[model samples]
Target: MNTALDPTGATAAYLAKLPKGAVETAAHYTQGSHWVLVIGKLAAVVACLIILRSGILPRIAAMTGSRNRQNFAVFATGFAALLLQALLLMPWTFYADLVRERSYGLSNLTTGAWLTQSFITAVAGALVGGLLFIPLYVIIRRAKQRWWMWSSALLALLIALATVFAPYAAGLFNRYEPLQPGVVHDVVTDLARQASLSGEEIVIYDGSKQTDRYTASVTGVGGTARIALSDTVMRDPVDIPAIRAVVAHEIGHYKHHHLLILAGAVALLSCIGLIMAAFAFPTALRLLGGGGVGGISDASGIPVLLAISAVFTLVTTPVVNTVMRLVERDADAYGLNLAREPDGAARALLATTSYRAPSPSRLEEVIFYDHPSIESRLRVAMEWKAAAQGR
Candidate 1:
């Protein structure tokens, strides 16, 4: 079964089709984001520090002055702290999300659209914070020493809810319609059948209104599950193979229960983080708490807890990313086997270079990438093709 086909050579020839300098330009944009990630974390810490030292939240909480108002106070102070952090990070957010994306020709948003989206996101985040943190504070007050365990359970529930309801939630922002009858639709339906997924779950969303990049995902569980493709991906009839390849990859995620796995992993990490934070809370309270902060249950202590959580997440990023990348690699292999369209998979992976760096050094990928580099994925696809042809 030995084949003379050189997968590496084939992959190189495929990549050589890219416009000169495309890879370098995309790489520069992505590499710069590593700095942005570091700066953003620092800014969040500084923002929390300001809130801790300012005594603003404690003053607001004190204004509640009634046992009945404690829950409301939690929401109010947590919402305020979140808003303040967002405000502090706004400059960096604007630069990184909009200006930088526009410079790289990746963003399709106008300033007005960006502002509208940002405002909507901010409002939604504040609402969710109010809903989440109020109950969180209640847990802290009642559970006391065991709050970390209870809080982790609550976090796990929220993660499950978020994952299951993601498609419906996304519809609030983007218009989704069932894909029309066509070659792409036919291919997607066939793939869905092979994967034993509901054909009714295939949808197309108007993502071109936001970005020109191709995107697709399978999300939710039970009745809420959907396989959604961005309109950009299906705009051209010739893109059928790429669309098939992407959808197959998404189907692989569903078959492997990657969403559930990721959700569980995040919840587990959060529990670990809370455990660590519980141990570290007292030291942080002493060093950063000042006169405004009282203790873990106090409104002012929220920022300190937040700062601790952010630090923990930053520290665990590489490990988290490595796990995610491995999952993605597994899915890629599954997709190749299921779809038997390695060339199409290779093409789809290459198309992602419109925004993603086609290749990053091993160290760069290890630290920053949650998906395998395109070069690696393409090589694997090529190898799959050669093996299939030989067989």
Candidate 2:
């Protein structure tokens, strides 16, 4: 191959603009977060063990003192345990989400902003958790031997609902505005048209309020479908070709319905995890001395259930990440082919190094990453360009 057409050389030249120090800093932050996440999962498991051993949940369940209020007891006990877990994890959350992000020059949020977002997110999560927990225990008690199957189905439904409503849920944290008439906007509209998407589905949002990273996605379904670009992309030093490539990538997601497909995949994974947790629940209860807990249906069993779920989640992280990474890489290929802007795609991927590491070892990427390394994605684009040039 000619030097001008060498994919590896071309990709390197495109990425050469990124300072080595910047890539190193991003890699340090990202890799450090991987360990933080692992440690957090371990800590959560330990907390659950402590809670179960303390018999605090049983004590909470006993507060109602009446079998008629079993539902209420379940809600109260579950909520209290969740609250305790949150309190236990607050310090770690603060460091990983706020302190560390700011240190890396990634977060654009002030302390007050962080606090506000955290409070809103926590409250919303608690409400959703309460709603789900009461019924989950109800399913356990009523369904008995078949609880796992029915409960998993319910969880799948909830996941689908969440996927459909995500666009609205996101509005609670950031303001979304329409893209103005401009080159970027026009390019996005053209790409959407090419991908058979409605122009009304594209919007820009104030994502810079939270992070300095360049981010975009196609969210929601049907009537709520939105191709959202962060205002970070609209700021000065706008790279038009890169924007076009990124938008095309998101358009590819929409065209292929990747979000719904991913939601289904996640729902299936959740079902598998729940089934495994159900099988382990009795054994776990026995190991924990079955203190003050009647069975899996008992409200006091919530801590043990949560612990089992955490363990399963930790074990399954790589599987979930692999599925997500494959979809992302496929979307990149689809976008490059559609947009015919391989250099732009390469540049756009390089821009992700603001927060993500540009490169990682194969094992690290397989185990920890939810997207292809920037290096690999750039190479894909360069290879596509070389093939196109040869043709």
Candidate 3:
């Protein structure tokens, strides 16, 4: 990994000194956390299946008393399984999200606050999963052999719906307000105008309430679309040009409709994964002594389905991450042209190295990063500057 410090710029200099070992430590922590969560959740699913095979889930279903209670059983089973996974993974979550972030000086969240947030996240996930379980179970029972096809369609619809409501959903966790009149606000609005985005879409959010990360994003779809900057960006010693470059990058995402494309790609992947799961689930279940579980509809089959889906996702990670990296690189190019501040763009890229490695191996970048490495991004910025100067 290229860890060379930029020799000429204040922003780059500050970024260079941002707590050594953070990049490698963060990468190890992140990769370890991902595998730990995956293994822990898979184990929990197996444990839940064992409990189901022991007739606990059936007993729980019996309590609903025969008013077409299969739907109730499915929801209850899925929720219980999810809760088990959460419980099993809670220690990892705390260590990865709260402890590691604090150790790296990235997070400002107190333990209580972090716990509250975790609880909210867990409850929210359970609620959404339970609600979706009803329809999913219906499709499984009704479609029989074709359940995966319908489920894939349902997944796509859900992705679309989530995209539409994501901005509102995000507001539940963080506070947002308009960018107050200032140079940052002026630069942001100017970029919005240049990108044909509405000034109303530009806002500032209290991101520093949770993390010290300086960042921005273009989120939501249609009327919900928003350009938001973290309070860290507003207050951090980053120059106006760097801030503008960041905003321009976000605008590039919006201008290029990257969100729509991303959602579509994810939806397509969901379909492919579900199609694979359709073929894999029954065989896996039969081998696991779960043939007694009635087709895909049986609440007991949830673990097998989950396991298959997880494997499918794991296998496809490289393809999906590659697509995301390409999209991000396109946005970088657009931002460079729009902002006309390659140096600022390079500085902004460096600023994020507190957590992200300034350089990563090509294979590592392809497999793990959804965005281009800082080295790649800075190189693009420098090349753009060189070309522009030659002109």
Per-residue lDDT tens digits for candidate 2, residues 1-391, read 5545898988788778899899889889889989888888877877777777888888888887799988888788888777777667777788888998889888889988888887777666756676689999899888988898999999999988887677677888888888788888788878777776653467888898888777788765554457889998887889888888888888777777777777898899999988888889889887766577888888787778878878888888999899889889878988998899988887778778977888899999999999999888888898998899888
The lDDT values for all models are 0.83, 0.82, 0.75
lDDT of 2 at 237: 84
User: In model 3, where do residues sit more than 4 Å from their true spots?
Assistant: 1-55, 236-238, 286-292
For model 3, the local distance difference test gives: 0.75
Q: For residue 358, what is the lDDT in candidate 1?
A: 82
Cα RMSD (angstroms) for every candidate in the order listed: 2.0, 2.2, 4.3
Pairs of colliding residues, candidate 2:
none
Task: Point out the worst 10-residue segment of candidate 3 by lDDT.
Answer: 2-11
TM-score-better candidate, 2 vs 3: 2
Question: Against the true structure, what is each candidate's TM-score?
Answer: 0.94, 0.93, 0.88
Clashing pairs in 1: none
> Against the true structure, candidate 2 has what lDDT?
0.82
Winner by lDDT between candidate 3 and candidate 1: 1
lDDT of 1 by residue, 280-344 (tens): 98887777755667778887688888788888888888888988898898889888887888888
Candidates, ranked, lDDT: 1, 2, 3
